[model samples]
Target chain A: MVETGLKLCLKQDHPIKLDINLRCQNNEILALVGPSGGGKSTVLRAIAGLYPIQQGYISCQQELWLDTVNTINRPTHQRAVGLVFQNYALFPHCSAQENVAMSLGHLPKNKRLQQAIILLEKVHLKGLEQRYPRQLSGGQQQRVAVARALAREPKILLLDEPFSAVDQVTRRRLYKELIQLRDSLAMPIILVTHDLDEANLLADRLCLLYHGVSLQSGTPMEVVTSPATAQVAKLMNQQNIFVGKIVAHQPKKNISLLSWHDRLIEVGYQSGYDLGERLCWMIPETDVILHRRYQVSKGERENPFSGIIIDYMLLGGYVSVLIEIDKKRKMKLTMSVPLHVARRNGLKKGIVITVTLLTKGIHLMPFESLR
Target chain B: MDWESLLLSIKLSTLTVIFLLPVGIILGRYLAYRQFYGKSLLQALLAIPLVLPPTVLGYYLLVFLGQSSSLGRGLEALFGQTLVFSFEGLVIASIIFNLPFAIQPMQRAFESIPREIREAGACCGLSPIKVLLKIELPLAWTGIISAMVMTFAHTLGEFGVVLMVGGNIPGETRTIAIAIYDRVQAFDNQAAATMSAFLLIFSVIAISFTYLVTERHKKYYG
Candidate 1:
């Protein structure tokens, strides 16, 4: 396992403060996801000893790489951490095999080349060992960079937006190769990326960072389904968020009544919420169900409401429907429906439809946690 | 024509380049990558030779290495020789005069190497010095070669500084420029023309070699 806790203050035109703690076990992929300049890359750099931390400890497999409190900071080369840069920083002058051999510094020159060839074969670059970085395709260069990094025999691997520079087709292939490589080498991997879809596809755990602070970290499902804060829900692309007041709480029944826009909305029970306390809640677009106004029975529709479909977006197999609720205040909710479902229901703009917001789909957070 | 003067010019230029190369690489790499409080001022000082008149620079060196100066006296105590009006003095003056030519290009070459490449080298478990030798220097070969050639060519054409510090003393200090001037003063235009043509051809060859190397470097790496 690799563990890191670091705090860094970068004094640029505007200062950035970073405080984060993370852990990754063997055979686990921990993805750091955030907006640009949110210290996602800085966390990886700190773990690799590229960025010095003000105070923290970093250890991998019982080896102490950094302990700032005791003034123990190993140099980057001395630490057994491999970092694959976004740009694939291969030596432009060195061929693929030579680049990999460069990492095998302890071996004799002949043995180094032999080992580098073995590693290159592992990355599926056997015949192209003599090609320079300029002669290699983007995907091939990235594979060579990975081979070079792995030649160091590091305890953990840090990939910094490894696939951002590749095309979609090549990216899919690289993803498959990366999974195979990860399986063969059971080391902890930390991937830094801004693409949420990529994180969801590859990572075992996700850490969401904002303005240098980690807002939430958990399995991808937990982070998407049960966000810790409203900001995290927004980061996860949850669109339907509203502020409501708890009108009443029925503790024995495990339900509550929330007053939102002249309507009482029934939601799952939440304790420690005082009566009339303001709260923010979100509902994922996928959990929203739409039915023909005449079809949904009155008793089956939990929180059904009729609204005009103001806009709709078609995305291949799915359609996003935007509805303007019929209330004195302006409130719009977005819901996703399968293309077949949308077609069957004749969902279109200007059409009045009924949407049920399921009780289990409404996730609430304290109003004070908005920031 | 004075053949010994031509040979002396070649020897002095060659020895000066050999001495300046290592010094230039170290200083160039340091200046390229380091940041300090007075970094701009230090860079300006290093560039003074590129703009300052050679005679003015030579005069300053003359004063700094004269018998009355402490450094001059210390050297005299150590080697039992005065610095002025000697071949050694010409070497010193040439080194100071051609320093910027050697260092600026080397610095530019070192700077042209991407930082990620160097960081990757370091991440490969190679030390900083090894990274410089194996990765940085090879990648910057064009700049290093250009610097050496320019310094050699600049030193070969030295006249003002050589005359100011090491007066025309036959084989010891009478370089090609000085020899050509003497021939012209004595109304031997034929010998002077021959010497000037030879010097011109030598310079053309050195500059052409530099251009050829740099062009090949660009094509190979681009």
Candidate 2:
């Protein structure tokens, strides 16, 4: 089988600086994850040829879409791109069927309506073909938008926060639909989203973007569990990132002792760091285990510490507990545990609890302050 | 009622609308979307006739299209007739004087459409022309209709510019408004009253229709 993909390298200075390089193979979905004003949508627009970039090279499926160096930029209409706008952008005056049919100009005029109905039906909008955009619910309008985008039979599909406008329930359903839709698609799909969980759920790979820069691109787990930099860790919502000094390296035990808040903590041996080197480290919430008050767990013997619970919030089936680990420095660690376990242990604010931070879960990086 | 002048008024208004539709659409969409160096200045210039006295616009048109000017001579040479005091010249004057009336509403209508919608049209592989025809024009029809109606009504009611530029050549240039003035000058109260009432009713109908469409558009879009 032939390998097909999209390769894009973009650089700009004024009017929102951007330095990004991305690649996505056919049959793969890559999510550009970032906050607003992070140039995620701008990247999508550039891919669709709806926005201009100062210097870039975009090639997809063995065709050159944009090459600023050679001045070979294709016009938006000339590019085979199917983009679902963040707002859906359906034609307000056109019926749902008409909106999809309008994009099928390549087909025979008599066959367009039939094709539009088939496409709409594929998106689960079967009986509401005659309704205009204003008459459809947000979820239904989004389905119509998806149907219209697919009507073009484009070379690449771009989704700009397609699920943001819908309710949470609808978003979950849409996520499932997209995951199923990905199986039938043979082209690269780029999805721009600000929600990390949505990206992790729907995308095959995640590209963390910040201020127009491509920070990291990898599998969702790779980026989440082992971020390349301290900033990437922070962007991944790692709440226990703390500054620590490497005090001693015990090659015999394969562990490095870190001096954190006047305590020597054993972590996985890191061969690249010098002694007394200041570094940043993070422990994922799932790696923090609360020691049972009555039962002694085997893992509780590793890196055990006592902390006063400062605050906690119940989020669905999980309780996010904030514990102040260092009294004078006011250092805090956020741990998420099952609601039932929290309730079983009577976990609440102002309670002193002992928790174990797994040694293997401690990920270290060069210390740098986030701007 | 001066039936000949009344018919001529309708003819002039219809011709003005027919010519102004394409112009209004192009200029309105352009003004609504593009940001050039002199965009605000151009917009202010387009709006000048709206606030300027009709007689002043008429005076400028007279000089610009009169026999003494080079453009007037070129136009005369091209068409084999001078533009001044002619029906053709009246159409030009009406289009110019009604620029704001024809363009403002349509520009606003085009502006009300979100930018993403146009970009989506392109992303769907519709060319720029198709986007304009299939997406933009359909969305902006109400505003375009309102502009046409306002232009037609305003042309029928215009007196000072018509008198200054076209000079009331009875069948050719004497519109209903000019005939009403002519009737009053001749002390014919019945004809003057009849024509005045006809114009008042027509203006009311045109304005009411425009308002109705505008309100419905607002309600639907909101």
Candidate 3:
């Protein structure tokens, strides 16, 4: 297991302060997901000892890697950490075999070469061991970099935007290879990436970071379904977010009523929110049910609202529908329906359709929760 | 034509390059990778030799290493000879005169290497010294060769500094440039013309070799 708590003050035109704490168990992939300049890469660098933090304690498998309070900061080479840079960073002058052998410093010269060849074969670059970095394809170079990182027998693996440089097809193949590699090793791995879908597909847990702060961290489903704040919901691609006021609270029935832009919406009850309190709420596009206005029975519909379809787009397999509820104000909400469902319901622009905002999908947060 | 002067010039240039290459690499690497107070001042000081008249530098060296100075007197007491008007003084002047030619190209070469490559080496558990020898120096081979060739070529044709310090001692400090001047002053136009052509051809060959090697390496590596 690896645990870290770090604080740093970055020196920039406008300095950014970062404070984060996280842990990863053995054989788990903890992905740090965020947008540009969010300090995801900086966290990875700090763990690898490339970037020093002013105050922190980083330990791996009961061994202390860094403890600023105790003044114990091991040099990068002395720490058992492996980092794979975004550009692979293979020695341009060394061949694939020699590059891997560079990490096998504990072995004799001949044994180092032999072990390097073994690692190359494991990464499926056996016959191309003599090729330089320039001669290898992007995927091939990435595999070589991984093999070299593993050659050091590190206790933790840190990958910084590993697959962003490769093509989609190659990235998929590498994902499969990475899963296999992870299965064989018991060490904790931390991956830094900006691609949300990639993180959802690969990581066992996800940490959402913004402006050098980790907003929330949990399993992919928890972070995506129940965001802690409105900013996090937006980062998770929730398009239907707006401010609303608590109009009524029926505690006995376990439901609350919120006033949102001339509409009264019933939502699940949340504690600690008083009547007349302003809150931010979000609904995922997938939970916005689209139905033909004529077929929906009034008694069966829950929180059903009618709006004119202002625009519609057919995105390959699904159709993205944008509806304008208040035409004068141009208040819009977007939803996505499968192409077959859209065609069956005759969904199109300029037509009034009914969409139900699912009660369970309504996530509310305090107005000041973002900070 | 004195063949001994030609041989002496080759020997001097060779020795100067041998001693200058290591010093150049150390200073060049340090200047390329470090930042400190007075760094710009130090760089400017190193570059003065490149712009100053060779005789001015030679005059400074003459005063600093002459018998009257403490350093020269100490050396004279130890070695039984003054530094001025000796082969050792000519070598000292050549090293200072050709320093910028040797170091600037090397510094540029060392700086051209990406930081990621060095960090990656360190991450791979290689020490800083090993990284410099195994990774940085090999990658900077072109710059090193350029520095060596330029320094050697520059030393081969040194005239003003050698004349001031060594005073045109035949077979000792009379390099090709000095010999050409001496032949011209004695009205031996044919010998002077021959030596000038030889120097020109030698410089052209050195520069052509540099270009050819660098081009071939670029193509092969790139």
* TM-score list, all predictions: 0.94, 0.97, 0.92
Which number leads on TM-score? 2
Report model 1's TM-score to 2 decimal places. Answer: 0.94
lDDT of 1 by residue, A1-371 (tens): 23442222222222457767777877788899989989898888887788767777778776788787778888888987788999999999999999999999978887999999999998999899999999999999999999999999988888999999999999999988877877887688888999998999999899998887888999998998788777888888888877888989898999998888689889999776788999888888987778655575554458877799999999769999999996458788899999998988888899998888889988888785544
Docking class of 2: medium
Where is model 1 more than 4 Å wrong at Cα?
A1-15, A292-300, A315-317, A326-328, A368-371
Please list the residue runs of candidate 2 whose C-alpha ends up more than 4 Å from where it truly belongs after superposition. Answer: A1-3
* lDDT (CA) per prediction: 0.86, 0.91, 0.85
Superposed by TM-score, candidate 3 places the C-alpha of residue B105 at a distance from the truth, in angstroms, of: 1.4
Q: Per-candidate DockQ versus the true complex? A: 0.77, 0.80, 0.69
Ranked by TM-score from best down, the candidates are 2, 1, 3
Residue-wise C-alpha lDDT for candidate 2, range A1-371, written one tens digit per residue: 44378899999997988999999988889999977898999999899898899999998888899999999999998888889999999988889999999889889999999999999999999999999899999999999998999899888889999998999999989999998888899989999998888888888999999999999999998898899998999898888888898999999999999988788788999989999999988889988999986678787779998899999999889999999888788778889999999999999999999899999889989988744
Question: How do the residues A29-136 of candidate 3 rate in per-residue lDDT, one tens digit apiece?
Answer: 899998899989888877877877877778887778788878888877887777899999999999999999999997888799999999999999989999999999
Q: Candidate 1 at residue B156, lDDT? A: 81
Best by DockQ: 2
Q: Number of clashes in model 3?
A: 0
Off by over 4 Å in 3: A1-16, A292-300, A313-316, A368-371, B74-80
RMSD of 2: 1.5
